[model samples]
Target: MRIIFLGTSAGRPTKARNVTSIALKLPDPANGFWLIDCGEGTQHRLLSSKLKLNRLERILITHLHGDHIYGLPGLLTSRSYFDGAGPLQIYGPIGIRAYLEGVFEHSGVHLEYELDFIEIDSTGIIAQDDGFIVEAAPLEHRMPSYGYRITELPQPGHLDLTKLAELKVPPGPLYGRLKRGEDVKLAGGVIIRSSDVVGPSVPGRIVTILGDTKPCGNAVILAQGADLLVHEATFGAGMEEKAEAYGHSTVLQAAEIAAKAGVRQLLLTHFSSRFDDEAVEKLTADAQTIFPDTVAARDYLEIHVPRMGSNASSV
Candidate 1:
């Protein structure tokens, strides 16, 4: 899996950054991509990236803040013209459905595809498929906000070829059945147990993406043991008081959460527009003091999240 940051600025846009949008691209291209947040100019940003509107499968909104959802209506409208005819699922807070319906009605816009809005009221497992499961939890934000934890399903282990060879098993449909953990009896009346020839199942990977929030317990719970933790660092170290007052987190607080969660890697984003590149670097350095694997996300940056036990790195 990979992550593409479309916008990284907080509250408003800057010369270098737009706002807060992220694209979580699954390993299978057929599954398309899931968008985390849709900040202003998000569709414009997508124009410059390799992602396509028609391939967008699902959208997961963090909050209703302008910086997080202003681009949603425009993007959805534009999708109609872009051959985005497949059914799309959207998950967000209670008002999300009303918000979109109101926009579409007032603007007299019609969509060519089906839109499924799944409004989230409580926290727990929000969505699940054969490949992955998504869980949501409340966060400490000025308004109602949430964080998402996505977990890939565990995969079957490889078949033990050497053991099969030792048993004089010929490669055929029986091998396929054995690989699927089925016991098969050979023509000679010898039964082979799949458990004796298959390795342990591979563990799935976890990724946590949080909305704008102050340091909170739910953040830690959502991010615990995640392969990648995306948290907002809207202020530098000395601005803790301002961050708290505004329902945001400073770089230090973000790093502390990453440390407590024991995540494999921390990605800091949603930077305040007041900080320039130099100031952002300084904040990242401060965060590294607490969590060495912290990365300051930038617009257009692509991060590759490998499988569990593999090192996650930026492209």
Candidate 2:
């Protein structure tokens, strides 16, 4: 899986960054991508990105804030232009459905495809499929907000060719049955156990993407042991008081959460527009003091999250 940052600025857009849109591209292009947060100008940002509107499968909103959802209506409307645009699923806070319906109603805009909204009232498992399970938890923000934890399902282990060969098993339907964890009885009446031949199942990856929030217990719970943790860092180290007052987190606080969660990597985003390139670097440096795996996310930055137990880095 890969994460593409469409906009990384906080509150409003800057020359170098937009607000807070992110794309989580699946390994298969055909499966399309899932969007997290749709800040204003998000569709415009996608024009420059490799992601396609028709391939967008689901959208997960972190909050109802203007910076997080202002672009949603435009994006939904624009998606109709793409050929083969299938049904879309949107998950967000309770007011999200009303918000979208209100916009479409007032604007007199109709969509070509089906739009399904899953309004979240409580926190738990929000979505589950054959490939992934997504859970949501409340976050500490100015208003109602949430964080998502996406866990990929475990994959089947490889079949042990050597062990099969030693057992005199030929490559045929018997191999398939053995791989499926079924006991296979040979023509000679010898039974072979799948566990004795197949390797262990491979664990899937975990990714946690949080909304604009102050460092909170739920954030740690959502991010615990995640392969990648995406957190907001709207201020530098010295602005803790202001950050708390505004319902935001500083870079240091973000790093501390990542550390406590024991995540493999920390991605710091939703930066305040006040911080220029030099200031961002300084904040990142300070964060690294607490969590060495912390990375400051910028607009258009792409991070490839490798599978669990892989030697690959998430840069």
lDDT string, candidate 2, 175-213, tens digits: 888877888998899999999998888898999999999
Name model 1 segments beyond 4 Å from true.
166-176, 185-190
- What TM-score, computed on C-alpha atoms, does each candidate reach? 0.94, 0.93
Cα displacement (angstroms), candidate 2, residue 227, comes to: 0.9
lDDT of 1 by residue, 1-315 (tens): 899999999999999999999999988745589999999899999999999989999999999999999999999999999764699999999999999999999999999999999999788999999889999999998999999999999877888999999998889998889878899998899999999888888888899999999999999999999999999999999898999899999999999999999999999999999999999999999999999999999999999999876777788
Evaluate residue 242 in candidate 1 and report its C-alpha lDDT on the 0 to 100 scale: 98
- Backbone clashes (count) for model 2: 0
Query: Superposing every Cα of model 2 onto the true structure, what RMSD results?
Result: 2.1
Worst 10 residues of 1 by lDDT: 25-34
TM-score for candidate 1: 0.94
Candidate lDDT scores, in order, read 0.94, 0.93
